[model samples]
Target: MNYQALFEQIKKKKSFLCVGLDSDMKKIPTHLLSSTDPVFEFNKAIVDATADYTVAYKPNVAFYECRGAVGWRSLEKTVIYIKDNYPDIFLIADAKRGDIGNTSKMYASAFLENMPFDSITVAPYMGEDSVTPFLEYDNKWVILLALTSNKGAFDFQFFEENNKKMFEKVLEKSQEWGTKENMMYVVGATKAEMLSDIRKIAPDHFLLVPGVGAQGGSLKEVAKYGMNQSCGLLVNSSRGIIFADTSDQFAIIAQIKAKELQKEMENLLIEYSIL
Candidate 1:
């Protein structure tokens, strides 16, 4: 989807929420295990339940890829279901893939061309060649990892080169390769305070923020600094929403959790005059 359509959905839904479908087989309700395509079934239920309160659905690829071939099949089924049923919802493949030139092109093609995701999370450690391949696709987004919420992010993301932090350089230099319309940065919600500085650099690009609920990232702080003119944030909650209740009513509980976030988001959008 293009940037205009994304903002349109956010306005229509009164939400900027992205539900994470990290549906681990071991974590889902046992009853779903009896189904032939347990993962897809679980995802379909979650999507149906929370579609009203969400503008996006992000599927963590590691959860499915870990299960092997069956897992891949389940992932495909889940993707097809979302594309067919909720064509307007922004679909993200949370596959942090980055490699050398040719290989990067293949990964980009696999997700952006074959699978039909609007965006895919990418790692930028290998520099321009590793990431630009993903940017070559029109209307496809490359969400590069920058200032993540994890503890280990401080190890390398802060490294200095020519007196600038590594992530600072990532934000500054990447603009030369892709416009805000096609490139975004993954700034974890836990780093909300730093967003003031980040916005100074990338001003208009959207941010895919994870680590909100289960990881204790504050929504208030994120909105305080991360939001731009179009409410440029897609806050994600994985285990907190999807695994809210591991029972027959799991999807219902997920909806409630999503609604709670949506309510908060609605208020923020209005406060920022984006509504």
Candidate 2:
């Protein structure tokens, strides 16, 4: 989807919430395991329940990849289901992939071309060659890892280089590879304080933020500094929403949690005059 379509969706729904379908077999309701494809079944119910409250759906690739071929099949079915049923909902493959030039090209083609994901998360540690290949696909976004929400992110992302944080440099340098339309950065909500400086470098780019509920990141603080005129933020809540309950009513509980965030996001958009 283009920026206008994304922004319109945010405005129309009064939300910029991206539900993370980080489904794990261990956490889903026991009854689902009896189905033919439990992962896809869980994802389908969650998508159906929360589609209206969320503008985007991100399925972290690791969850599926860990399960091998059957997991991959579930992922394919999940993406195809989203594209066929809700084309307007921005679909993101949270793969966090990056490699050498040739390999990166294949990875890009696999996700952006063959899989029909609107965007894919990519690591930028290998520099332009690793990322530019992903940017070659038109209207497909490359969400570069910058400041992440994990605890270990501080070990490297904040390392000082020439008096500037490493992530700050990543944001500044990666701009040369792609424009805001094709490129975005991952800014963890847990690092909300750094967003003020991040905006100075990437004023127009969108940010895919994780770490809301389960990770204890402040939603209000993220909006205060991360938002732009277009509400440039896709705050994701994975465990808290998808696993709201381990019972048969898991999807219903997930919708309740998602709507809570969406309602707050609507208020923030109104406060910022973006809606």
lDDT of 2 by residue, 1-275 (tens): 88888989999999999999998988889999999999999999999999999999999999999999999999999999999999999999999999999999999998999998999999989999999999898788999999999999999998997889999989999998888898889999987988899999999999999999888899999999999998999999999999989898988999999999999999999999997
> Whole-model lDDT, candidate 1?
0.92
After superposing candidate 2, which stretches have Cα over 4 Å from the reference? none
**For each predicted model, how many residue pairs clash, with residues at least 3 apart or on different chains?**
0, 0
Candidate 1 local lDDT, 90-123, one digit each (tens): 9999999999989999999999999979999999
Tell me the TM-score of model 2.
0.99
Please state the error at residue 245 of candidate 2 in Å. 0.9
Give all TM-scores, in the order shown: 0.98, 0.99
RMSD of every candidate to native, in Å, equals 0.8, 0.8
